[model samples]
Target: MWQNKFETRLELEPRPSRYLLIYQIVLHTLAGAALLLPLILPAGVAFVLLATAGGSLLWQVWRHYREGRGTTRLIWRTDGAWDYQIGVQYWPDLSLLPSTYITRGLIILHLQPVKGRRLYRVLLPDSLPKEQWHLLWLRLRYAGFSEEDVGVKG
Candidate 1:
């Protein structure tokens, strides 16, 4: 779960349908190294890189925790009264042809604060199960976005 707003007493938690645990483990391990490796480096340079990676990792962890705790959601909430959200499912050969792999379907979300316009995008990867993709879409839409509000161009 995740939320964009810190106030208003609202929290959103959205678990990764897949890769959730693996992602957490990898991120935590890298963060741990970043925090620990600086002790061996030459102080000046090591400290910088360590600080950058470790700090980022720590923050990511905090975000993940907050999301899990229903304190935040993945939806981008802007102070400008604008919000936008999108999800993408990478294909098996995403590394080979990054752009054209979503030949079957794509999913996206777009919003225009000034224009009050919302968009939806759905792009299906050949590798993804059609039923799972639909379920994911349904979940996303129920989280406060319209099916037509998300787009896939970007």
Candidate 2:
């Protein structure tokens, strides 16, 4: 008989990616420009409007940056047991959730929030790995959840 050994450590590594840094820089530059546009405009009203828009964009950009920094850590194990820390913005009416896997080892799973009874918009990742998706499916099945409970849109 053959067996596999497992090691627990960060899977994606800790180094910052150049692509991600570049993207962040571009986003901040755009926000800065937006904030500056209002000041450059000739009229007060136009300046005020642009400034407000820029301020909102700047706030959004900063929030996005914080989230990226916070979620930089990824966890994985050689035995296939893995869990990634993920989060979504608040929705007034709806709640979003990601499905989880029960076992570990070379697994991919789809994580999505469950819809709330009330109406609210929830943004979810477009696609997750098929292996994780299947693991989530089996876990849900084992938990006695119906197919409807595991349905992911987006």
Best by TM-score: 1
For all candidates, the clash counts are 29, 14
lDDT tens digits, residue span 1-154, model 2: 0022234332331222344445556775676566565465567666676567666656766665665565432343344333344454332211223343223222223332244232222222122244444543343344333435434331
Task: Indicate the worst ten consecutive residues by lDDT in candidate 2.
Answer: 118-127
The total number of steric clashes, by the backbone 3 Å criterion, in model 1 comes to 29
Error of 2 at 7 (Å): 25
- For model 2, the local distance difference test gives 0.40
> RMSD to the native, candidate 1?
13.6
For candidate 1, what is the lDDT?
Answer: 0.39
TM-score for all models, in order of appearance: 0.36, 0.30
Sliding window of 10 residues with minimal summed lDDT for model 1? 90-99
* True-structure RMSD for candidate 2: 11.6
Query: For residue 79, what is the lDDT in candidate 1?
Result: 24
